[model samples]
Target: MSNFDYDLFVIGGGSGGVRAGRLAAELGAKVAIAEEYRVGGTCVIRGCVPKKLLVYGSRYSSAFADARNFGWTSDSLRFDWPTLIGNVRREVDRLNGVYTRTLEKAGVRIILDRAVLDDPHTVRLANGDAPISAKTILVATGGHPMIPKLPGSEHLISSNECFQLEELPASIAIVGAGYIGMEFASIFAGLGVQVTVIHRGDQVLRNFDADLRDGLAEAMRKRGIDIRINTETAGIEKVDGGYRVHFKRGDSLHAGLVMAATGRLPNTMGLGLDEAGVDLGWNGHVVVDEFSRSSVGNIYAVGDVTDRVNLTPVAIHEATAFAETVFNDQATPVDHMMIPTAVFSDPEIGTVGLSEESAREMGHVVDIYKIVFRPLRYTLAGRDEKMLMKLVVDMASDKVLGCHILGPDAAEIVQMAAIALKMGATKVQFDMTMALHPSAAEELVTLRHKWEAPTPMAGSDAAA
Candidate 1:
């Protein structure tokens, strides 16, 4: 019918690429997806899935400690790293197979080789096969961890290599305060490892609500985590049994492990996108329009590789929108606003919609309703942990603008909250909804008064 090796050729068999390939096939397009390493990409292979498993594994110590208050007993509690890591690896391998099979079942050919653009319509493979030409090309190559070029940085492990570590370190010094670094800090600390979080910024989680950032820092410190803010790393030098991490200001920290969770950059190196005339942003991400069409009409990209939002779900959403727009003849623009996100750190954090700062900066007269109270679960365990619930509302329209939660089940609670917020539910609607008794989430609907900062004591610095 047409002169092309396939209708669509997708590079990167990650979640977004897989979804696009599968949907395009269902819409009657011949598709072939290429992956160099594994089918599940970063999230399933090295990121969210494996990391969440480690978070669950690390949390057992707290559960074991709380069992006493719950009237349960274990004479001896021990954790085996090999067993947990082995099982996690097996699960990851199984998921990789599952993803591979899903594409096969969807009638999309899965190519297990590195692929790059030979031209706008041709895909060159690393296997030395003849180049395959497609009517359209989609890139969903995802991203990789970014590390600074410092002396002896080779000794530092990234978030990607954490799962594959042969053994957990006795102590770890994390070099960033992002969600990734903080999550690992919680994990290592929960598992009785000495964890020190070093950050150059004044606080952790820079773009998060200030209260939540400060609250999390205090909670982590109370758990014996040494959070060194305003500290800069000069370089790293190997020592006898560990590493001596040089500080910028004439000091050093010694630890069994040093990790750089600085940030992530799109995986766009040597893919030949730039030379092919597909536009890339200054950050080296593929610049695409609302429907994911790149500068070249037949080229499209979706996922972290495009750097819009950079979440796995957001990538999948973009991919679906791409398939809908290109294949189904329906014009769909990605709505990049009001995405719910979570940090699975100790105590956890979940937030959606605009932050209070964002709402205020956008010239909305806002009402900030907040409550911080110890959860009922902590009462019996004698764990003095507090749960935070805050709602930012637009006074003029009574529309709920933001929802933020910090504490246990924060991710789950905010997921349900996001649905209501997405539906444009108002503050009055939240109030009209009945509160579930004795639940942390009930506080969201029941909160009535605006929060006011406590006045400084007469002799305090603020008063002075």
Candidate 2:
């Protein structure tokens, strides 16, 4: 055995773990990362990369239909599901190789085995007989999809399993209405699958502004997705050729395939977290402080394992901040404010900062501005699609509280607004900026009317 095993031992070769290991090694620390699965983890391997590719592939269906209205003619289009799946798999393999090489280039030793914490400072590899010692340990195992207990849920597929399907179904019934569920609904709808989305909640995307959520539901419905809100899946069964999904909202639905996109839970089972004196939340997520330091001083946790913002970018940010503070002695904390996020539905949704309802609940007098109009390109193309833009501002300070968009390139456009919000830009500053004519983004700077204002207090109440 080598005299020095490692200075930092990171479990789970995910975005946060890989980043932290590389950065620590670059700073002259002996770092090693252990991962039993693919090095690129969920985002590059199965989650974000493949999911977006499917979303892109599926969108061609609608594009082909919309082309006719744009004065274009084409023969009947055919989709080869296996070919698309093969291409996506190839891309994921290339990324996995890149991630592997990156760690070696950064002087990080890679251990291809599950890591079990023997102590706060020691980790034992599941495949190896020897135990590795380190000064600091990090848990970044991330999360796994949660499939609820239904009578015949075993017959249902998961988000992870969806990518490996050899053939695309003609129709599908999806359970849940979170981001994952809605994203899949949009993807399948675009791929020409008759999609039925059943959710147990009153509205989809419960975290987003109610207006945007409702608008997105309406848009998806218009695109031919059967959205069943406040609905519950009673059971599933194997039918003659496919699966039969029995659901109850106000009615029932039968589909070819039953998919559960309910949500994801942390992958913390059998990791020996309790044995190492680490505390976990009720849902099995490791508890950590602002700097991602666990209950055990020498142990740290980040990524989906912490149950913090589950976005890959957020985990990367947390990892970078943790490494800077712990190794470089730089006292930096991650700022969750104005963290822009996107939902890759048919009409993409993007937002930064607080929602209108959240702003009002925070005791701010909000001035809401909204614009719903078709873009110039759509106008020329003779398409019926309309884009929605909303701005929430503090009436007293004129500070821009939030920005939201639902339309094409919404993710790309909202990123710029996120930067402005991060820099503390106000409504006046946004309004004063020159507009880009005939562009969808120009709507941000040209909104002339306020949608609502907080009610003023009466004289007696104000005096009191």
In terms of TM-score, the best-performing candidate is: 1
Best by lDDT: 1
Count of backbone clashes, every candidate in sequence: 0, 0
lDDT (0 to 1) per candidate: 0.91, 0.87
- Give candidate 1's error at residue 159 in angstroms: 0.7
Q: After superposition, how far is residue 142 of candidate 2 from its true place, in Å?
A: 0.6
Candidate 2, 215-306: lDDT as tens digits: 89999988889998877888898988788877654355667898999899998898889999999998999999888998999899989999
- Pairs in clash, predicted candidate 1: none
TM for every model, in the order presented, reads: 0.97, 0.95
lDDT of 1 by residue, 1-464 (tens): 98999999999988899999999999999999999999999999999999999999988888888779999998877889989999999999999999998999999999999998988999999999999999999999999999978999999999988898888889999999998999999998998889999999999998888778988999999999999999999999999889999999999999999999899999999999988998899889999988899999999999999998989999899999999998899999999878999999998999999889989999999999888887777778888778888899999999999999999999999999999999999999999999776777888988777888842221101101
Candidate 1 residues lying further than 4 Å off, grouped into runs, are: 455-464
For candidate 2, list the clashing residue pairs, or say none: none
Model 2 alpha-carbon miss at residue 369, Å = 0.4
